[model samples]
Target: MFKHAIAAVLLASANVAAPAVAQPAPAPSTAQAPLQLWRLDCGEFVIKQYGAFFSDTFQYPRGPKNIVGSCYLIRHGDRYMLWDTGLTDALVGNTFDNAAQTLRLRQSLVDQLRQIGVRPEQIELIGISHWHFDHTGQAGRFPQARLLMGRDDVELLRGTPSPDQDSTDALAHWLNGPGQIQQVSGDHDVFGDGRVVMLTTPGHTPAHYALLVRLASGPVLLTGDLYHFTEQVANRGVPPFNHNRADTLASMDRFDRIARNLGARVIIQHEPADIAKLPAFPQAAQ
Candidate 1:
């Protein structure tokens, strides 16, 4: 159901006696250039219960229940970063059935990324919105990239038996890879220009996060499960199963304050309506 042989990194034992070769070194990622943002459809889930997404705060609001899994790509000069990889590419043909949600893929994430001329290896860094399986689906595809995740999430993944069955067992390989994991203390600036910043928006998990990419057109805030529904943005619906209810509400408050202050378009990653915030695939926002 998918083409994964070329996922990235095929290592082999070295031939120390092999002849010396000359090759051109890849250019550094510091070259200044305008940023380009591309949105990709990773997968979608069928939500049967409105109560499933929120706790006591939710009142069975009327709206569509289906939610999308959004994966984002950011190109800064020669540097590339992937934010919140959707459901695993291996799950392309299969269905994810569990207590939290049931996800089915429209297309593999790598295939969508390839449509825009980005190979897995081209991604210099992978920013995990949090350690949830839905967001870290293809993390194993880019083991070469430095994985920037919240310290609390790192701890979450380290414990036995993942919180959600939606995760890929192979993702553990990527997380445990040598020198690939970079546990962030809090917010991290991907570039020195402060254009791409990772905000620590915990509560959804112990230390969930949101990505803020400042493009020439405008600032875009990719809310990572801070609010699954657009109505949550207004009603402040806190998921019942979230790690900490107080923390979830606090995180929502901070998220709203930042969105209002930046005058940025807040994209509820699951809500399909927010897809219009960026140009369709093959065309970038900036």
Candidate 2:
């Protein structure tokens, strides 16, 4: 009986898995290339009367504020996306000025892209934060790229003429070919990997959105007119032309919460001061 028991114990010990040697995580699958972001000099427009045009309650100081028409180029692996086309290239030589502001473009977006060996055709997607003229000015340049915009804004573009409608010429390509438009209703993850996302924060327009780019350096939040200037972040100032004041306030609160949670670098696209958060043009944030 003792000998039979000893044999059973030996067999059980041999059958037991040999301590299940742990292999070193299979080398992590050659981690995907880091994402890259480029700040493009789309154009600039000086708000002649900041208080009159920007703040509905005249919260900001009274002075001419040089609001930048900033654009961004994001590269994830091989795919590329352009955010906010900025003021029209035509504004380069002839600075268009009205009672509210003066729009000017020092360099064309195409030329800027050319400097970094990126062509208009190379862009896979064009992200419009809003349908304003300044943001969609150069959108026509990339007709082949998919248009990702707010659903409400898209409806406005397709509906009858309204004050919110700009020339509509820049978006004529997408307008004519509705197939190319992606009418985003809520937060959108551009790459599915969660590297690039568009957060819907409407107020400035019916469907305005802010972009969140996850970079190796850190996350970045591109305020798509959510807060034109940094001051709006603190004061929760809503522009006089905003569609809904309550929605704007809520969006501001949400934006602040997100930035705080992610420890993100917030870049007010129109604010000249925010430009320094990223590297100068030609160079990229990776």
Candidate 3:
């Protein structure tokens, strides 16, 4: 019953494709040659609650905060890793709208992957940013791949979610299934070369984490929920619904420190402006 209400608020809360970044045509791709990163358009959403309600977590919540749901696909050598699964394709029928803004599904993630010649079986790993419903919508689709998640969040899957269409319920099968799961505690180097690493950034959830993808172009950081919008970066605002306020604040400081040290370009998962920094789908960021 505790998480059931969260499901309701989430469903109630929450489009636009950021314009593509200008860049030269991508280099030719090979299975073992180039590292490829593709950003998929999972879905889009806008907050509908009044200003006072949103102000609890946001600094300037004057209007409906429109944001996009993003997922990523990375190809390293012959191995493939999926960042976040995005919203469930099955639920694409329901359109969300408010007087201020509206969000509709432009495409499905499975379809997006298919466009890039990636089959579900070709996915070697599925790394979830957190345990949110939107992020885990398509996780169960890849049964052959291993699931990587925070140890703290992995432990949360032991119980049942309120029948209110919770994400915990959507991801429960994979969480409890026969597939292998890597429960990470702190920082993790995915390829052990520092090219691809998982940075531990909490606050949105107990075990929420982020990803760092290095390419020939530069290093890119996928901020899970550390800062949903670019404004949150400067404001350093904590949502009212976060798991731990102090944990969130600490993670923010660390998140910025590492990026500054490496000069990484931070990409907020929900911010459309940040999405514009990446090459559009079908164009790998390598």
Candidate 4:
């Protein structure tokens, strides 16, 4: 049902054409960036209750219950960093809306960021795990931030068009206009020193990526859609829907080993239980 809804929504959205003209270019800034990272829930951004559903190979387990989508805010010095923007405000209330409904993103990602005291302008960088609409919804909102993404994902977004033309808008804003986009070929150290590192974890998408944050508790690996929940990690189960099965399995194995070796906590983006364990913003508890 969720998959069907998503397909319908994508089909409906695909009718709209992307802008023909390019946006202006981003200006280089020497502003001192801040280094405080905060994780914001941004409310439930998806609706698919993929708790029990299993993928074809059963390498991973579906969550016990439905999972809620999430967005993260990283503060570096004075500048704000956004990881995986949630669904757009326009689609927040529509029940029949596929991406909006499945992701359960009732609140605007921009609004949630502001609620935590960071405005869009303060954002210096925006990193995406993949080009999925749910993860890239608010990319256009941060025109000033340097958009960081895997090269393959960028290509995929550029190649596709949707109802809102979100991918086109993001690319146009990042590529054509003043938006500074840094297309990394592979993994990148967000702040250098391993405080926050972006790893290329393909499989969910050809260019899917994961984030590693060295929090006070320990290192936290943000597995964006790689595995919907901890059960997926424990049981080695994949979601019914994904771009590639083999790649997803490989990425999961990599995550498990890396976390074990580093004694890091793996935070699955869609798992409510895992998210509950983390300390909310303003109060950082491991």
Best by lDDT: 2
**All models: lDDT?**
0.77, 0.83, 0.76, 0.69
How many residue pairs clash per model?
1, 0, 0, 36
Residue-by-residue lDDT tens digits, candidate 3, 115-162: 988898999998898887778888878888888898887777655553
Per residue, candidate 4 scores C-alpha lDDT tens digits across 1-286 of: 1000112122224665753444443322223342454666544634333442445555533443455667788765565678888666566665433532444446677777767677788888899888776677677878878999888777766663532366556557875677788887667877654567888788888888898877655677888888776656767786666778889889888877888998987788878887776777555433
TM-score to native of every candidate shown: 0.83, 0.87, 0.82, 0.76
Provide the lowest-lDDT 10-residue window in model 2. 1-10
Candidates in order: C-alpha RMSD to true structure: 12.0, 11.6, 15.0, 15.0
| Local accuracy of candidate 2 as per-residue lDDT tens digits, 24-88 | 32221215756899999988778878987888887877888887879999998889999999887
Worst 10-residue lDDT window, candidate 3: 1-10
Residue 1 error, candidate 3, Å: 16
> Residue 270, candidate 4: how far off, in angstroms?
0.4
Q: Rank the candidates by lDDT, best first.
A: 2, 1, 3, 4
N/CA/C clash count, model 3: 0
Tens digit of per-residue lDDT, candidate 1, span 2-30: 00021333344576555445454342232
Model 2 clash pairs?
none
Q: Which wins on lDDT, candidate 3 or candidate 4?
A: 3
230 Cα displacement, candidate 2 (Å): 1.5
